[model samples]
Target: MSAHSPSELELERRAYRARQSRRSVLVAIASSIAFALVVWVTVINTSGWAGVQQAFFDPAIAWDALPRVWEGFLLNLQVLGLSVVTVAIVALLIALLRTLQGPVFLPLRALAAAYTDIFRGLPFIIVLYLVGFGLPTLADERIPVIYLGTIAVTLTYSAYVSEVIRAGIESVHPSQWLAARALGLGYGQTLRRIVLPQAFRRITPPLMNDFVAMQKDVGLISILGATDAVLAARIESAQTYNFTPYIVAGILFILLAIPTIRLTDWYTARLRRREQTGALL
Candidate 1:
């Protein structure tokens, strides 16, 4: 075979990769369709198929529920937005505190550790209930449900996020910290400019996964009557005596979450590609 120019080789490699990618995608889709057909056949052959359709798949009910449920979902979007900021700030601070190097910080480290352990070990529902309903008993006036739900989400996710962030920080070689210190950077400066950015990049996938979970868990806040989509669905179901609205609400959430999940996967894949390119060069 004749030798190829660099540009020709690059073009050939790209074309080969594109063909392989298309083949893989076609195979995946074919497998999914086959699997889905099998499941559909099995389901329709079951004795309860008609009942299931009536209860869960009524097209008219789904259509009717869409508008109301969507309105409630807007509230969920707001909660998710606020909670992301709240969780990220609190979790990063907790992670940093846990990573402190001094004996004087022992107490703060212990406190942060305890906080994470307690919150992580608690059932999410319990935390939501305690924050949403139980706290108001001690106060003279009712706390706004939105704030309470946001607090509950923040407390729960921060514990998890802080631990993920801590892992990312610990994954970085200690030599980097030593080098930063040797360069006369203070602890705060080293962390701010060097450590955290790398740590956060490492934790991006897990953090995004948590945010997806948070997107759904905020549905639990509907239990406090905050009138989010799930709550709206529940109310509509109560009035109509059908469960299809809940299914509609669930479908909406899945649709909303798919984009985030895809984005996270893409970013993680892009990072891997970049790392491989660097390694190869």
Candidate 2:
């Protein structure tokens, strides 16, 4: 069969829309340029701009610090990598415990609830200090600072991620459980095959947000004398009294976070589109 040709009015409307799109793009670019120029002019004209630039934006200092900071950043990545795995395991178990239905499970549920409440209420830095210093004193063998830091991170984030996972699990419709059971699926099978997949899909954006937050927080391990990026920056800064290394570390973290941030945004929009279109999967 021959394809039907577009009508004259349809072609004209398409051309009009194209023109509008082009105009919008141009306007956006122009406005962005203007805003940037205003910011540059305002910033440079400030009284302390020169001192601030020398202290925080020195190219030479940044270049000098980059290698050490990058090395330390690898440690941060290691902590983050281990924490992600540990958090997933611990959080999933806690979430599952919280969701279990039985009179006998009351203690488990209460413990999970208390775990979340306590950790979530405690400041992360305090937890880091407690775990970092307190753990070392109790063990006869010397424990690595990195390990202690990772444990602290795991303890803190597991509580938060468990809540997120539990919320996702609860968000699944009750009928899904009944339908899976009606098809001869066991509770575990229903959760694995039917419920968790959907819950993960629904919760992915928030999960990614949590992951990004984790990426930044992993640098906190530096406080435990683990010599991560932040400590490296501090060392470099102390040498010359220039804060530029700190800026370099900040930029590196921002660069690390950018891809995940963009991915989260893209997936969130994709999910929104799917939901709007009533996609089943």
Candidate 3:
């Protein structure tokens, strides 16, 4: 055989590998199906499947809950969008403040540190309660509940995001900052033009993770009865005496979360590849 051409043995080996790969995939699928079927059969036989069906699998109840839950989910998306934007902006500022150098910036740095610590230390529900119920009254009750809830989310997440942003910023080497300074760039210019871009790229995976977490935590706003999916489900369950609406809401949340989860996974994989490449270099 020519140097580039496969020999007969090589052709047979390739064919065998391809067939093995296909067979392995089929086996995996069949095994998964069989395992699930066995578990399901056990559950159905042991537990009263009829009660389970009535509680969780009622099609009519699900159908009735769908429209209201969807309407509430739209509100959830709105709040989540606003909170994410707010958190991003606030966290960036806090991170910048936290990273500031010298006595001139000490107070700001301390305040930023305190903010992150206090907020991060607080339970999520307390933040919701304080912001949703407490903050509005300070403004003579002018703020709307949805707006207040958004603020709560913003306050709670900004602490976490600020830490992530700070980590990203600090991960950029000191040499890059010095190099920018050597080019006659000011501190702000160095950060804006040289450091932040690389930092953001390096931290995309963690930031994506943070955003995914925030997506699900957005459900907490429903506790304030602002008519989010969770609240909608609760209301429906109360009316119907069936818990299927909660399941429906849970499924809706899972559906909403899937894209972010996939994106997080993709970004993490890419980050790993880049780190591996750097290690090789």
Candidate 4:
């Protein structure tokens, strides 16, 4: 190969370095602006520097309501786990029905669509109330409001998850199904062995996103009289006649949300890399 001219090579190298330098400067400026804005808002809204100092050193509120807050946190975790598991199972069934194509499937698809649309359109509080109060009257028996809240979360979230799963399944290539059928695999065998595994991998990021969304929705259970973290905080605040319990609860929610956020980001990045490598191959 012929060697490049010195001037041309130097110009290309300088251009590459300039692009990297510009990106670095842009990132730094953005970070600085964001940090300054956050500080300005915090100072302005929180009674200046003195209030910020007091907030950091405030142990009085935390010490008093820690027990109640802990209990509420545990309850929140329980509801989240139960609701997420229930929703996942329901979502998978809905996804299967959605993928089928026939006159038989039309009514099933319509029902799934209605389920998704109604719950997604309704406010979480309304669903909570309907389940909590409406069910008891209809059944003529007192259902525990907490269990009702779990059902509400599961029903609403499963609708959303079903759509996610259906999209994931549809993204798989038709050739995979053709190949499986050529090998004498039945519909169920092809779906189980060849389709769902790939779909699950593709759907992992959205599933993680749904999970994080569900974590926040756990607070909605509190509206139905479930003693979730938010409700616990409110009760503690009422008893102590202090705003600190609410602040404590907010911090706890942030703490809980952070791990889910991190996990989602990590899984998304990993999947993206795998997808890119697969594409290149």
Candidate 5:
């Protein structure tokens, strides 16, 4: 019997073409709809656009709140950057602890699990309030609200990130561990040199997704009076009695979020390609 059949090859080619056509049509429709919506919004919000234009071009209004907005943006970036870095480090530690197996590891694992469960199960707003407002009152010390908010976010996000790291580590094949052991690597050495590296690559997509989520979660800090981008816009709107500032803030958020989203998609696609290549190999 021949390995290739003409009719089967033709069917496979036709199926591939059909799938490509469907994807192309979906993309076209989505693009068209998005474009149309943007046009419609621009047309309907002409007055708001005019306000924003005037505010930007008019030196008085532009200069008045611009500095405050920039300051708030810087503060937001600081909070976001600090929280993410702290969470990543702490999560890694917790994940490591959780993965260890022994009687002595039980208490440590229980503590890590409790931390994750408590934070992941609670509402972010409640956590923010507790950390920002409630803690200071209890401790009788005046902690900066911004610092409190940052800590709260860090704690909450670290729990979720720990789970990601734990899952990533577990996904590394047992054969890889055995191979590392055969190479005379100890448990810690095997994990650090082989298992962790592979797991890190495997979890990059999920980690990036968490980053995107954290970026938006930064907005929640505003509820704690952290004066982040959202709070800045709200304050500006309240003082000026105009909605343009809020609209501007929303646009800025979309600007920030869209790029992160694109990067996430790119990373996910790259990971999938790597997986496919590995499978083929």
Candidate 6:
């Protein structure tokens, strides 16, 4: 059998689509350059630009601060890694508790609901302070601040992540659970083997967004005297009376978050396209 080549009309359509794509790309690039140029002009024309640049954007100061900030950033990364694992475990348990469907489980469900509600409404910094300061006193032990910070982050984020997970679980079709049950699968088995896998797929983008947020917030551990990047930057800033070290820490955090942020966006768009078109890719 001979393969059929594209028809002339099909070829023309492909060529036109290619041209349109190229035009779109070129237009995007041009618009970006124009916007950047306008921003540069506006900022440089301001009377305080020179002082602001010296205070916040001094390259020499950034270089001077980099070693301490980098060392401290490693601690932030450690806390973030620990917090991610703890948050996932705690959030899943809470989500499961919230999803339980029985009068016998009413108390558990209510407790979980109250936990999420309170934590979600509370500011994370306040939680950090409470956990960082209060927990050590209660234990009557000299606990490390890094551990306290990680615990605080896990508690606050678990509330948010649990809601996202619960939403994903609820978004799963009820019929799937019924079908699993009909197949003689227990409730836990149905959730673990059938429902949760699908829910996780649906919720991955939001989970990643949360992870990116955690990366930035982990820097806040410095408030507890863990000497994480933010604290190191502050110490340097105080010594030099320049804010450049803070900018350096901020930039490092932005760099840390960029990959996860982009991944979340890409996954979101891919999920949207699959939902709209019924395409697996």
List per-prediction Cα lDDT, in the order shown: 0.91, 0.94, 0.90, 0.84, 0.82, 0.94
Pick the TM-score winner: 2
TM-score of 2: 0.94
Per-residue CA lDDT of model 3 for 137-185, tens digit only, reads 7887577767887899889899999999999999999999999999999
lDDT of 1 by residue, 93-164 (tens): 999899988899999999999999999999899998898888898786889888888999999999999999
Worst 10 residues of 3 by lDDT: 136-145
Q: After best superposition, candidate 1 residue 197: deviation in angstroms?
A: 1.3
75: Cα error in model 1, Å: 1.7
How many steric overlaps are in each model, in order? 0, 0, 0, 0, 0, 0
- lDDT string for model 2 (210-267, tens) is 8999999998988889898999999999998999999999999999999999999999
**TM-score of candidate 6 relative to the true fold:** 0.93
Candidate 5, TM-score vs. the true structure?
Answer: 0.78
Off by over 4 Å in 3: 1-3, 7-23, 277-281
TM-scores, in order shown? 0.87, 0.94, 0.90, 0.82, 0.78, 0.93
Off by over 4 Å in 6: 1-8, 278-281
Candidate 1 Cα outliers beyond 4 Å, as residue runs:
1-33, 278-281
lDDT of 4 by residue, 1-281 (tens): 99966798899999999999999999999999999999778775565666654553357877777788878878888888789789989999988988897897799888888888898788877878888888889999978766787898898889889999999999999999999999999999999999999999989888888888888888877877778788888898787666677778778778988988898899899878876995773
Candidate 5 residue runs with Cα over 4 Å from true position: 1-67, 278-281
RMSD of each: 3.7, 2.3, 2.6, 4.4, 6.0, 2.3
Candidate scoring better on lDDT of 3 and 5: 3
